[model samples]
Target: MARTTKPLTNTEVKQAKPKDKVYTLSDGGGLQLRVKPNGSKFWLFDYHRPYTKQRTCLSFGSFPDISLADARHNRDTSRELLAKNIDPKEYRDEENRINEAAHSNTLEHIAEKWLEVKKANVSADHATDTWRSLELHIFPSLGKVPIHKITAIKTIDIINPIAAKGNLETVKRLCQRLNEIMVYAVNTGLIASNPLAGIGKANQNPIKKHLPTLKPEQLPALLKTLAFASIKTTTRCVIEWQLHTMVRPSEAAGAQWNEIDFENNVWDIPAERMKSKKPHKVPLSDQALNLLELMKPISSHSKYIFPSNSDIKKHTNSSTANMALKRMGFENKLVAHGLRSIASTTLNEEGFDPDVIEAALAHTGKNEVRNAYNRALYLERRKPMMQWWSDHIEKAATGNMSLAGQKGLKVVSQ
Candidate 1:
């Protein structure tokens, strides 16, 4: 037995009462509106497909947004699909799934999810840096777009504005961060493409000022000025360690006493925290050994090798190193990053292999083979290399050019 609903006037339908009464409203086609007792209206098509005998209910949108006429139009269109052997409800479900997936897999949403997933893996200090760059520089601009929609033009729009203001370093870092997130998204099936893959270094503002390292000759003067910068003890320790071992400043700041082998004279940085995602074994130089010895008594109980009593949580900020340069009047001339430059420059002058220097700095490459091959830290080999380097800096900081020959020179016992 089928139930039939009476036709209703426009005014009656507009002020429809809630009951078991079902009002049938014409939708200008074979589709009709069925109003339930709850006053919720739904549109259903009554027309059979042109060639098919099966009657299907093609759902149109809800009452308010979709007018009765449009509902009828959509129902007719669905009927056409039915004629072509397609189940409209099933097709609509597939389309809805795709739309929902797109909304979820949008670039900004996925990047944020990636951040949340890695929150514990990265340090408070490192996590904050990555977040700040994305929130302030990258996300505000491109946060809503789907990751695959990220094109070169969009990248330029996001990056060039910052680059024009001489924030080339920031731009470069933002690009790297974007690449990291997008690559993560691609691997996880969120996106089919990476915006950062294959774009050469030159494409990212190649003409910008490249950070330079202190030459072997300049090391003496630079060290002298850096040590005497008259700032916090933490800055001095940071700069000294930067020169002593040539490890990245962030790695040095995050170093723990347990990671440093005082007896063996090595700082084994875990692969997770290292920039290259490979373990780095930093051989403690004579000076590095001395520095640790001095620091042992200061913040001995704290986990951080270079701890700040100012706060129990954070070790130290990157600004500490830069401010030290500013105090020594090398503000723009020398930055915390320049310490890496100085190390790279001096290592080359001292005749160490380029690959060794690259490994020491934890630089990863595009070639997976080369990257895996160069991950070896060469600790015993790097020991004398670091020791010679530390001694070389000490001589220069003391203003003696004759100290250059003294490098790698062993003292013979009488």
Candidate 2:
């Protein structure tokens, strides 16, 4: 013989008074309103532990916070768990922990962790560029999403817009980067497996395009346009410096005064700034030296030879030469990087040793031993060849039409 409990109503719960001692008003099925002597009311569900079968109580909330309707809903949920031999308390705690982890393990957060691990293996500039690409492409949409919840379809939706813009290369890189992050998550035990393993297979591969460059004969016209172009003197000097030095735009722009060896007539670029991650010595032609002398008054106090107009502590944008080339109406005709191509073509056509030309360009071949030997063997040979290239540029600057017709095109080793 058991006494069945009556269900509590909202009116009864609201009007229930507290006694000198703690007491409960049962609503059946283990749900009760716990009225304390202090007059505070709470919803409690008494149940047996799943495995131990020990009796215990789980608090839903206070009466006003967990209203009669809300308390009944929670009790029904707890009853379902009990029928499955699951303890409601354990289940709730596990759910809370999972939610906490999801909030903390966002995609951006995990990407940052992966980058920290990445920084040790790559150059500083490469690491910075990698993070910047992620910020520009991936972070706006998927940054806040939990790492585990990121699926391939959602990722493709985000990347499809970039692909539609004909920026297939950017799409390819984004897919590769996302997959790297997913693999990192899997390795770290943050997620079960990588859903983005083959994400790059979805994108159309980007065609490899070389930088637009001018023919050797066209250097005269290009130099003439640069001389009279309506651009800053500092910008013009940067272009000329890169032209004479045969270095990459970023390497030229980031040149520091300390890197110059005035006695040796060379510019020693550190390994960190180089693409091959090796220190390189460029023999400074008289033309390159003249460009340096011109920049001394303007940037002698700053570390960088071409300091930014707004911030003297930093170098000017690497694109300054490119932008100037565009403003001079060389858009799609030539780029700053193409300046290197011009120098390479001219040097090769002039019949200098191919090894010396490659050494001058700081190019590394697949053979590590040969590259090391060339770096040591070619410095003296490269100096005179660099001088000859500068003399050719000088002739072009003065409107000398063709390389074959130019005089003093000889390399005399110093």
Candidate 3:
């Protein structure tokens, strides 16, 4: 016959003195408190494996740390698991392993890994901006949260305040970063689905403020100011090139000497450097070529047309032209990017084809089919339009803003 054991109360267990040999005070149902000769008391649960019927003892914790009631509660949980034909110890070990994995695979951990892979694909400045955005906005609240626990509703709550504060653009960017990290997690088997998918529509639309630009009448005075400004010659040439080509400030700043083709009178910008991810051809007017010739003396030794002032080996910062404009008392009034708007507005008002104007501005089409067609058809007309624009600028600078050449231009299909 099996030996019968009596349950012990917490007070009786605490009052019992340690003996020469270790002895167990039973709480029934395989839960017991074992007191050692050194007076250390431990709680253990004895159970039989459902499959093999082998007995094993699983530690619940120490006495006082885990009270008699807590140990009984843990024992009941183990009994429930055993009733399902699962070994209690194995189930507990698996639970601990899952918890450990969740702790290690937090949102911040996955974001860092994602960023490390991303840094190699994007520009240094772009990668830096991404990192800074996470550090400032996303990391503080959700960084340590397990990726699986980050729900769409929770994410929207975190980002809605930023949107409410009138930083819809930042909220959009943060949502994009969260989406990327969550996708990375899913791909790596950290989660089942991305919670941040379609979160962008949840944000308020940012107020649109067109970039500040100079009017057609204001261009001549701005041109005159830039022409004789006491600034670096590279800076002056960069500003001139930006005005002539109407390319983005980054495109001009990162221009390489080899990208220029004096024979063909074009500048072929690689797709990687372009915002549209499509290769662009900038038709070089005679005036543009002349500006390049002037710039060669200053930056010819370096590969870039506008090499960095501090580090000649690298290209000049994209902000070089804007900073130059700011120092010329045009802060908030004229930005380097505003030159594109100036060109778009002036050329359109002058009756030039909008397609030609957009092509010259290197604006990408919204759809793939339209973009591919625009890339091929716009080049021919853009060459003549570019020359016309340069001549118009020259005439305007000489106080002849009324030159008539707007009647013969062909309008392309939209």
Q: Could you give the C-alpha RMSD of every candidate to the true structure, in order shown? A: 6.6, 5.9, 6.3
TM-scores for all predictions? 0.72, 0.76, 0.80
lDDT of 1 by residue, 51-105 (tens): 4556656667567577655675687787688678777777889999977887757
**Where in model 3 is the C-alpha error above 4 Å?**
1-4, 50-54, 113-124, 137-206, 399-414
lDDT of each: 0.70, 0.87, 0.83
* Higher-scoring candidate on TM-score, 2 or 3: 3
Please estimate how well model 1 matches the true structure, expressed as its whole-model Cα lDDT: 0.70
Model 1: CA > 4 A from native: 1-21, 25-30, 35-42, 46-69, 84-87, 104-106, 114-128, 141-206, 350-359, 362-377, 399-414
lDDT tens digits, residues 63-100, model 2? Answer: 79889989989999999999999899999999999889
Write the residue-wise lDDT of candidate 3 on 254-349 in tens digits.
999999988899999988787766789999987788777777778899999889999989999998899999999899999999988888888999
Q: Using lDDT as the measure, what is the rank order of every candidate, best first?
A: 2, 3, 1
Candidate 3 lDDT (Cα, whole model)? 0.83
Candidate No. with top TM-score:
3
For model 3, the run of ten residues with the poorest summed lDDT: 405-414
